[model samples]
Target: MGSLCFNDGVQDDRQPWWKAATFYQVYPASFKDSNDDGWGDLPGLISKVDYLHGLGVDCIWVSPIFESPQKDMGYDVSDYQKIYAPYGTIEDVDALIQTCHERGMKLILDLVVNHTSAEHEWFQESRSSRTNPKRDWYIWKPPRYDAGGNRQPPTNWRGYFAGSTWTWDEHTQEYYLHLYASEQPDLNWENAETREAIYEETMRFWLRRGVDGFRIDTVNKYSKRTEYIDAAVTDKNSPYQAAPEMWCNGPRIHEFIREINQVLAPFSAVSVGELSNTPDPKQVLPYVSTRARELDMVFEFSVIRLGNGDLFTGKYIYKPFTLSQLKALTEKWQCFIEGTDSWATVFCENHDNGRAVSRFGDTSTPELWRASARTIALWQATLTGTLFLYQGQELGMTNMPASWDISHYQDVEAVNFFAEAVASRNEQRIQATKHGLSILARDHARLPFRWNEDDNVGFTTDSAKSWMRIPREKGISVESQLGDRTSVLEFYREMLRLRKRFQGVFVFGTHTLLDRENESTWAYIKEGFLTTKDGHRMRGRALVVMNFTVERAPLVDVSAALGCAPESTRLMVTTACGAVRGAKDELSAWEGRIYCDFGPEICI
Candidate 1:
């Protein structure tokens, strides 16, 4: 193939290695249990390096494995340098890194510096006394008293988990802020010394240990609004209010990210920020733009947040959405990043989301399950960005059985929400909340990996129990689908291979959404230039079509849209079974296809 060319004065050849790489996110707790301790550890992850290498992944992003009290899992870090005992020792991490490097794959760790466990030494010292030198390291305020002399939290802002963002400390007679759980107190970025300490302890500590980079958690929430004012009550039913403006995309977020970039620049580390709070493309561009010198890329949550209710209710109340809505949200991001120096992170499932096959596709039948999984994979693989595949997703994993009760949930977010529902004593509200949780709870993705049809699904010894409940879905394990040519696992492997083969078109080509109004069909064309071995340059156009519904759908004539004859288009890949005679006029249920047309050699 020929080299990629741009209309402006940009060179695709100069792109960073990460920009062209595929990432696989490993959520350690449920990945694999090497010691049969019911929890996945670093050693177990190390043993699976070869499996990821075989999957065509170029990078591995492991979620938090740091020493913690496990209040919010490992998100509440108590020791930045020490490894979580359940996950394993530092030696295991070294082995995992060396193993990944041997196979030419990079490794990134989750950075959760926005807050630390209240048990952290710094927090312990800071809360000991108001005069302690470390008191300023965390955000703290004096409690406000009402007319009746009852002490109240400084502000009416609600925490991400629930309740007020502040927790009163009787020892210091002051309230400290925590945007998340109270045990996870928010760090004060206003303190220069605090910022310096976090950088030295977290970022530099790992970079020196040979880790490639970081997946910064809540990256935009580090710099928060300093004014300690009450958030206007948007939901009057609740005492506290959602305050994204006060704590998200704060005044100093860019400055903080620039400092982080400086620390990462020396190591040439890649930074993919979790910018959940900042959804606007214009607002997020500076963080990832080449000229801005901030993050390399950031994960946007708009697509994931679709079909969800308000912030307080969150995903507890499901709202029906159309394919047009999905298409518009996707196109918005794709077009926003086209000409800009910034990049995007293409993903449908993660540690915090329900399985893609269950949420976005049909799972009413076995055939539809596999087809929809392949369709979703095709859609993500063809997008212009870094791809991240969560574990078990390649096997078309679905959510936990809807019949399971709240006792099976181990996630703090889900358990807390359920507790609130039960506390209300409203049976109707309780039933609705439980039904919603069955569909959208984060615990759905926290189940043990299904390796085979053994007890505990081969995640652990047959005699041992896994950390979370294993799904009862049949014929969805790796061992079952590994040898099947038409299985979801095989389709993922094939799709990823094709993506790597045509990186120029799939990763850097211009994207144009076709038939944006269609609710059942998603069609888009990617146009770019490819070079031949004999030094001739040719323009290449790739058309991707997907039937997003569970029924047959007629797609737009992409050949006519691209001004190319039907016979000239070559069938590159398809999820359809059996032999495809020629160009297709309509797609079968959940079918996806890609066609490539390389016109006669042309010079720009």
Candidate 2:
């Protein structure tokens, strides 16, 4: 496909754009508590710049810092131009921007454009008088009529949080839409003014402030399935769709994204959509593609590796992907974006995702967290794109309070789903099954970072309790693990160093897969490294292999296809620190192996 593959072969001249960049994601609320108020503020984050740089990251991706009423932990933004009072002030944000740029690093804010807080001035005016100039800024309609004039939501489609997508306003006697929570009203992108206001002002506000990029929350939700046609009522207890094809990749999605991209082009800003429900490869392709108007990259949730269990349907499910299943998810996306400037942002855990350490392997102990984290880090980082590391992920922090009962829980979605299932389905006591909904709800994963064994896991400063309870420890603590080179944190530190060293291969390499039949392992190779910012003067090969099973799972011969004989390749890094590094046809369990085809007994 032209010299875009470049000379050295690792990076594409088609897009030498992303070589040597690494992104670290921060959940501002739990990153650091600079103030003693028990809340994590911007100043708290400022204190950790050195720590981030020390990890050798090229960029930092911070979660929402906008002004919000916080019904959804700052996701429901009240003011696009304002920072949440709890996060810190405008001065604190400026300090962060200046600090990051000075360190030669870029900062990307989490942009919540799918909707705004109900308290936003736009929504306030929309709800005031039906004839207000901004009334059309948000979707509003007359309530659905049953037998009497008594009203119901306009549609059967449920909000992500639960219940009807429409909310009633007393002042105008009309219904307003909320795809997520009632407090976060959906913006009517169909309105040119609304789109322009959000695009121009939001970009200018941050771009002028020196922010580098953004992680657009629910990127596909902007246009809605827009005919506003009634969603077929299926799954009586299910308020939403098992899959909403019409809603996710809507008609005007590309048009809206292009409008935003034009604003971002001059600044070289990186914008990745937090794409959800993109079950089809073709539908998922355009958003991250380089072919036309789309984003620089899109974050994929393949690593979440969710279980198939239908707790709501009374079916117990377990999820362990076959070798081809994972290869399909990771490689399909990789191949789709190969020719485009649009790229994929690779990650495992984030603020809303469950802890990868626990989800991938046993969370029974902190050491296991380390093993799982190391294995996962080693694998995803080897892919062809930018890297994303979530907060506390390096420490291998796990899912919150494993024993958390219904009384201690606070996730809105978790609670609402349980109530919905009970009220609508009459399922066998769903309230009692609130524990089941916790398995998939966003809250199960978004707890505070655990820094110390001391009060509040050192997440908060004052006597106040943390936003979410920290998971109990069985030998995991940053203070305790910092000095241990063999700890998970150190492993992550080294992994970053290694990937940085091989930036050309991991970031710019031509992507291809080896074996597809192996059920319990993940395998791939990055070949033909190209010249990057640094001169690449030689030929080389890099292979990534991960043992998905905790038990030993043999890998198919990937070296044979890449021109490496079994005897010629050398085994490099191992997830298990103390284990002897070797080149057996099969890998030991949960261990990841990176190989180089230098020669027999290849030199390190």
Candidate 3:
């Protein structure tokens, strides 16, 4: 929440607050629990304002806390205006908003308009009868009859949580579409009434409550291919087909986004869309482009999908990826955003993704774990975009231990996938699926936040069991790392501080990836200009080098990478222990360093 002074010791009013801000994503259920109800609530988050403020985060994006069945962990909203009872009341949220702003921070709720819970009044009314006026509010289609005279779903497209995308409604004698879980029915954006209701009831209702903006959930899935044709079979094991093209970024996506933008413009709000299934930068540009006037930025999944399997298996089936591949995908986005009006959102871990340290860092040994965690922190902090840090990421929290069985997972996606795998009755398949889930399951990120090494990791009191499994791991808690200079949490603080110190270079600079083919190293240079207080302009560049392997990495020429002399560069920060002797000929295992040549006066 602290002001970011870019150049000349003056805050850059030209840039939007979000353009250079660091956002912290709080999974309400896992963040903290103050009521001792085994679930985290708004009051618990309110208690941590000082913690977030100290971490240098400017905005907090809380994943869905609306009234829900919690079938999808709050993503399935039963009521837009009401707060989930377990999380807290509307009054608690108002207090949270006030608490955040009182400390100079902003709060943005998760806008999940793509779907509503089956128990929602709107969906209940829509399904009451075929002639109901709200029947068109959701995507409802008559079941198709097969040649054998058996009823089938409207189409053969698979739902995101597995099974057919359409669920049969016996009362209405029709099938309703749900891109995700059957409990979450997709809204028909083609209906003007539905769109307007979302804008007025869901969006405006919160904006009027002083909420900054929204992190739009499934932003690109608002529109769907109305043809209702069968999708091509991408996964032969399943009867339904995996067709993102049929549901993601469909015909009317931009129109819907423009309409939402109009709603946000009056409030001067910022939006970061969760744009899925559109990996191509060209496809992503329209949503975030200033000329398009859609969203402020977007969360693209190309880099996150590096080691993921096919669309159907997704992260549940993991594949190995080289550092070169990660560098290429990252640079592709970084280069694509340069000079364009469109902006980017940089993140590794999120509510749906596995822990960043487990996925991107070496967690085999304690030493490697801390080093790799710090290395990933440096990598993310130096990227040319708005940085989003997931809860517990700063403390190097990792995925649950491999010994944990399928019962530990509370995520609907993981539970469904495991059931399907077990139903297959193939031991090989079940074991492989379980192994993959251990490495990449969404449940890993949903574990209760480790506040300390207390019972239930200090997420709640010992009398109340956490809603989800608390990891048995030790030492990766806020209390444990609070003042330890060598801890991953401390490294994150230093990295964020350095990022603020060189905001001009880190935020507005041009990103250039170096050693494109290097498998053991990831290096990039950020170049920009900063003006001194006395009206003197100085050019600055930062060279970031990271060793992504457990083995020592080959030497990287610091001077050649940044096109500056070695003497002019200063060792800004490093993950390696002891004082670094300028630029070394070789980097130790899992080492990361940042070198800047912005002059002594400005670098400090």
Winning candidate number (lDDT) = 3
TM-score ranking of the models: 3, 1, 2
**Whole-model lDDT for model 1 versus the true structure?**
0.85
Candidate 1 residue lDDT tens string, 126-197: 999999999999999998889999999999998878788899998899999998899999999989999999
Q: Of 1 and 2, which scores higher on TM-score?
A: 1
Per-residue lDDT over 1-604 for candidate 2, one digit per residue giving the tens place of the 0 to 100 score: 2212342433444453444478888888777887666678899899888888987777888888888888888898888888888799988989999999899888989898878999999888988899999999999988778798777777766666656677889889988888878998889988999998998778867887888878889898787776566776656755554325546768898999998898888888878888777766667777766667678777666545454344223321244445567677778766666655555667767766566766666665555556667787787677767788888778777665646776555767666655665675655556435544444445655676667777666777553556665665645667777778777778788888767665556665667776667667777887654332334344557788887766667765756755778777766677776663324667665778888764322111
| Rank ordering of all candidates by lDDT, starting from the highest | 3, 1, 2
Off by over 4 Å in 3: 1-11, 579-583
Backbone collisions counted per model:
1, 15, 0
Ten-residue region with minimum lDDT total, candidate 2: 1-10
Greater-lDDT candidate between 2 and 3: 3
What do the candidate models score in CA lDDT, each in turn? 0.85, 0.71, 0.87
Clashing pairs for predicted structure model 1, backbone only: 2-531
TM-score, every prediction: 0.96, 0.89, 0.97
